[model samples]
Target: MKNGHITQKIGFSALFGCMLITMFFLGAIIYFTVVRGIGAISWGFLTQVPRSGMTEGGVAPAIVGTLYLTAGSILFALPLGLACAIYLCEYSPRGFFVNIIRMSINNLAGVPSVVFGLFGLAVFVKFMKFGISILSGSLTLGILVLPIIISATQEALMAVPHSLREASLALGASKWETIRKIVLPSALPGILTGVILSIGRVAGETAPILFTAATFYSRRYPDSVFSEVMALPYHIYALMTEGTHPEKQTAIAYGCALILMVLVLGVSAIAVYIRQRQRIQNA
Candidate 1:
């Protein structure tokens, strides 16, 4: 027993050490980004359009585009993903067909981002003639995050106690009614957590958007879903890799990265607040 206790202590210490190291690296990234990017952030930077080959002016277009894309993707993915989770968790039997679907979802979640981009290009852009518009990009991103949301929501739904279902049925409630009134509310927090994670992933994706929706430089905000738009991730990539004015453009890239990070974090905070409130009310 003493030897086992000592071994457990060593294992825990190693795990904690690894966690700290991971956090330290993350902190370093944020610290460097802030140090380099703070000077470029201002009202003008946030609200003006890029000019002079993107060496002057602001990133307002990118900001608006990113918002549009993120919102569109969420709108497209949320309901579909939730419905899929519900079917898999509540309606489907544990058997061969369900197993195949679960396996496919897991595989899809592991597919590379660039592959989604290519698929989007082929299907949405060429076949559907979306032509590098926000709609195509959003649909691609929605597909990319669908598996994540479905997996998260399924886990959440499954976590609802089986006894709750049994008691509801015992009280003469139908399965669908019980799920709607009781299970859904109980599982909301976990579902929100999944949504938050999906938002983060969708917001940061460059590859999928690059071929489908993002432009290297766009002067105006997108007027419709069919319009091509500037996104922060693609904008940063362009500035760092394709711009002639490296000094000024690199600073702007850093600033864009900072803005993107803050945007994601802000969304995550709101989702977390909602989830916490849900848990409190449920409790």
Candidate 2:
């Protein structure tokens, strides 16, 4: 009895220690980012246009470009991803072709962002003749996020109880009708969470946009999807690499980092809130 009690105590102690370490690492990251970034952020800094070199200027254009890219990517990716998820979960039969499709999607998720950038440069910029523009960038980002969105959506659909589907079928609902009314509504919160996460990834990505969407110096907002835009990550990279004033450039990098962090955190908070509400409703 004493030996069993000691073993249990050891297991609990190990689990607690692991959790404590994880929390400490997370806290350290948050503290470093916030401390380095806070002073560089201000209303004027966010609203004003960037200046050449290390001169203090605002990041309005980069901010706007980031928003445009994120929105465009989400719009392009969402429908195709949802459709793929539906086909995989509801329609596709177990076969070699289906297995291949699933493998391709999973492999795509593991590809490096820089490789995606290279692919975009070759396909979108050269073959499609889109050039280095926002449209090309958005398309590339959409491809990058597709696998994630599809996987999440599939999980959401699968989470809906089989009994709910049966009930709808018994009530004379067609498969489409059952999915549209019963399955979709129950899965929406999870879908939204996936979208929010994808947005965060899209916003943070620098490599893919570097090849397709970004320009070195763009004082004006993009007038159309084909126009080259200045994005926050690109700005951060440029400042760190080429700015004459190293200190000021570092400050700019920190500022951009802070903004990106805030955007991601805000979206995550909303997802968490929605998930909690969903749990309560389902309960």
Candidate 3:
């Protein structure tokens, strides 16, 4: 018993150390980004267009473009992923084909972002003739995040107690009705958690947009889905690599990074808030 106690204490100490280390790194990144970028957060910096070789101006266009892409991606991915997960978890029979599909989706999550960029270039940009627009980029990002959504939704659906479904049916409720009313509400928190993770990824991705939608510099803001737009990730990349005035562009880049982080964090906070409320109400 003493040996077991000592081992358990050592394990707890190790786990606590790991958690502290993870928090430290995450906090360090946020601190560094905010400290470097806070000076460039004026209203004009956010609301104006670039001028004088993009050395002087705000990132209004890029900000709008990133928002468009993130929203578009979610709009495309969520319903499709949710439907697919529902079919797989609630309707599909256990079999070799289902196992294959599951494995394929798991493998897809591991595929590199750059590979998705290349695929988007070939299929969406070239074949579909989307012409380097927001539509193409959004579709690419939607695909990139589909696996995550599907996996999360599958887990959430499965986590609904079997007894709950049986009880609903015992009340003479149809299968679809029980799933629609009972299962879906119970799983929404987990679904939103997946959405939170996807938002972080979709907002920060540069490569897929680099090939599909983002322009290095645009004189006009995008007015349609077909129009090319300046996005924050590509804007940051361009400021670092393509601009002549390094110091100013670098500052702007950091500012853009801060804004992007804030966008993701803000959305995530709202999702987490909703999820918590849902969990409490359900409890």
lDDT of candidate 3 over 1-283, digit per residue (tens)? 9999999999999999999999999999999889999998999989998878888889999999998999999999999999989989888848888889889899999999989988989999999999899999999999999998898888878878999899999999998999999999888788888888788789989988888999977767899999989999899899999868999899999999999889888877887787778678778
Candidate 2 local Cα displacement, residue 139, angstroms: 0.6
TM-score of each candidate? 0.90, 0.91, 0.89
Candidate 1 global CA lDDT score: 0.92
The backbone clash count of each candidate, in order, is 0, 0, 0
Query: Rank by lDDT, descending?
Result: 1, 3, 2
Task: List candidate 1 segments past 4 Å from native.
Answer: 1-20, 271-283
* lDDT per residue as tens, model 1, 8-111: 99999999999999999999999988898898999999999999999999999999998889889999999999998999999995889999989999999999
**What count of clashes does model 1 give?**
0
Arrange candidates, best TM-score first.
2, 1, 3
Q: Name the weakest run of 10 consecutive residues (lDDT summed) in model 1.
A: 274-283
Summarize candidate 2's per-residue lDDT along 1-283 as a digit string, tens digits: 9999999999999999999999999998788779999998899889888786546778888999999999999999999999999889978847888899999999999999999999999999989999999999999999999999999999889989999999999999999999899999989989998999899889989999988998756678889999989898888788888757888888888888888889978887888898888889888
Highest lDDT model number = 1
Per TM-score, the best of the predicted structures is 2
